[model samples]
Target: MRYGIVGTGMMGGEHIRNIRLLDDVSITAIADPVESSLDWAAQSLGDQQPARFRSAEELAEKGEVDAVIVASPNFTHRAVLEPLFDRGLAILCEKPLATTIADADWIVERAARNPAPFWTGMEYRYMPPVARFIADVHGGRIGALKMLSMREHRFPFLVKVGDWNRFSRNSGGTMVEKCCHFFDLMRLIVGAEAERVYCSGGIDVNHLDERYDGETPDILDNSYTVVDFANGVRAMLDLCMFADGAEHQEEIAAVGDAARLDVLVPPGDLVFSPRVGFGAPKQVVREHVAVDDMAMEAGSHHGATFYQHAAFARAVRGEGPVEVTAEDGRRAVLIGAAAEISAREKRAVEMRELDTTG
Candidate 1:
């Protein structure tokens, strides 16, 4: 299969590298407005030459590709996807499907009518340990799950092509920008839709002294968001973008009546703690999940990009189902939109308030 990458930035280059690892697949084309990004993609492509275009429109018109991966900036997703959708090409759009709910709703509507497969790229779901954790939770390892909490203590956002991510207007706020991955995971693990969202976040640490055109960055660096799912499942996210010194960049825990399950990303350990009476012998088991060396080397996402691409390839070949659909992307964006509103308004926002389906 031949693939075309819409944005040739860091994530786009990651996709190119991992796609090269897939059998019988090649990155046939790439498009980006910035020349430096195009050069970066070229470097990643090595000797394999793919047709290069300056814009998605140009690529859609001139490039020959079986499927397209939209890794463009958050604000430009809807615009970049237009021509590709019109061409009836299979698409794997990166998450927070769109910066706003209206655009996400439009994408959902269009995707439902398209004949080709539409995939939302939620890479975290494919992480080996996280995938196992999700399966174990659903397999009744954690019986009657009561609470879910996630923490991402990582460095600040890296430099994009044009500093497009420093502002909420372009990146969809920190909640929708970075937290969408966690929100998506929360929904997937809990197997329920979010009913309400409450968040307290602000631009506390990162990018304080940075200025673009005399305007300081407005994106939040830390946050605490609570999501109330329809099935009475409550999830909380504790995000600290300034805590790069921490040992684990991401950690997730799910507690139930029976026990609690936890997964740490770096070492990729799954810990199971069963309910034991006080003073009883504690039996806490820790198992390490391993990822393919090549897949791990290909990207920073702990081989998730490779696994997600593998699944996407199967979907394109009619060998498997599209695991993450346009609706899934929309729902994730809805929860994120609510979180952003809640943080700004200092109140809990009901899911119905942002229900674009109606």
Candidate 2:
């Protein structure tokens, strides 16, 4: 299958390398406005170099690829996507599908008319340990979920080719860019749509010196958001971008009436404990996932990224259903967008207050 990759940044470049590992899958074309990025991609592909286009639209118009893997910036998905929906091509679009509900709405509207084979790139679901935890919740291992929480203590954002990432406006705020993965997982594990969000945090550190001449410097470095699902469940997300060398890069826990599941990272694994407050004694079940010890520090061990791509490739080949739907992609963005607003205004934002339908 021929795969055209847009945006040869870190994530895009990762897809190019990992996808080529699959049999019969070829990196057919690449698109990125930055010449250096294109050069980086071309140099890596060597004799197997694919066709290059400066813009995604040009690649789409050229008709050289069977499927497209859109790892473009958060705000650029729609531009690359709107042109290809009616072409009946399969697409694996990266997160925050449109960066905002309005853009997401636009993409969905156009995408619906074509019945294109579409998949959202949400790699967290493919994480072995996280997937197991989700399965345990859905399988009734944790009855009637009540609360969920996740924490991400990692290094500052990776530098993008353009400094577009330093601005929340361009990157759709820090939550939309970084924490949407956790939000998506929370939604999946909770099995409900978020009805409201209350957030608090600030642009305390990280990019204080990043006063880009033409842009407003308003990106956040830390945040804590509480999400209330429509089903009466609650989830909290704590994000700290300055925790450079924390022992655990991420962690999560799900608490239900009957049991609880706790997950820890950098050796991401799970522990399930059944029978809480009512019982004095508890049985703890642990799922020990053999995660890479240096996954986070080395910043290159994204097994989930690889696994998710395999799933997308299968879907592109009409061999399976998309693991993450466009709606799922949009909802994740909506939650992040709302959380950002709530954080800024210091008020709870409801789904009704947002233009989710548009």
Candidate 3:
């Protein structure tokens, strides 16, 4: 399969690297306004050099590609996708669909009409351990899950091409920008839509001393968000951007009537605790999920990006279904936008208040 990548930044580089690991595939074209970024993609390409363009429009119009990966900045998602959608090429746009509901909805509308596959790049679901945990929960091992929680304690956001992520306007706030993965997982595991959202977050630590053109960064460094699902399942997220010292960068737990299940990254272990008597012998089981060495090295997402690319390739080849759709992307943004509103207003926000139908 021939591929074209838009926005050759850090993530664009990651995608190029993983695509190289797949069979019968090559990045035949790449587009990015930044000459340095284009050079980076060229260096990553090594022996094979694909056609290069300065914009998505030129790539769609002139480049020879059967698929495109939109790894552009958050705020530019909608605009970058317009020409690509017009071309009807298979696309794997990265997470958080858009910075706002309106733009996300727009992408959803266009994606539904496009003939080619439209996949949302949500790699969290494909992480081996997390994938196994999700299957166990869905297979009734958790016994009708009642509550779910996710925690991401990691370093602050890294430097982007132009510091575009330092502001809420560009990166969609921390809730929509970084936390959308957890929210998307919540929806997937709960099997229900969110009814309300409450979040308490702020830029307490990271980027406080940083400035761009005399303007301070306004993105959140930590937050505690609670979501109520329509199926009566409650989910919570604890995010701390200043906790890089923590052992695990991401952790997720699911509790039901029978027992509680937990998954931890880094070591990639799945822990299961079945309910015993009040004082009976305690029993706990831990299983390690291993990822391929090359896959693990392809990206920083614990081998998720590699697996996700494989699945996307299947859908592109008509061998499997599109696991993550544009609607899935929009739903994640809906809940995230609600969280942003709740954190700013210091109150809970109802999902219906967002009017996602637009």
TM-scores for candidates 1 onward, in order: 0.99, 0.93, 0.99
lDDT of 2 at 298: 25
Provide the overall lDDT of each model, using Cα atoms, as 2-decimal numbers.
Answer: 0.94, 0.82, 0.95
Best model number under lDDT: 3
Arranged by lDDT with the best first, the candidates are: 3, 1, 2
True-structure Cα RMSD, model 1: 0.8
Candidate 2 error regions (>4 Å): 214-216, 276-282, 291-301, 356-358
TM-score, candidate 3, is 0.99
User: Local error of candidate 2 at 107, Å?
Assistant: 0.7
lDDT of 3 by residue, 1-358 (tens): 9999999999999999999999999899999999999999999899999999999999999999999999999999998999999999999999889999999989999999999999999999999999999999999997989999999999999999999999999989999999999999999999999999999998798988998999999998999999999999999999999998999999999999999999999889999999997999979999999999999999999999999999999999999999999999999999999999999999999998996473
Root-mean-square deviation of every model: 0.8, 2.4, 0.8
| Weakest ten-residue segment in model 3 by summed lDDT | 349-358
True-vs-predicted CA distance for residue 312, candidate 2, Å: 0.8
Q: Which portions of model 1 miss their true places by more than 4 Å?
A: none
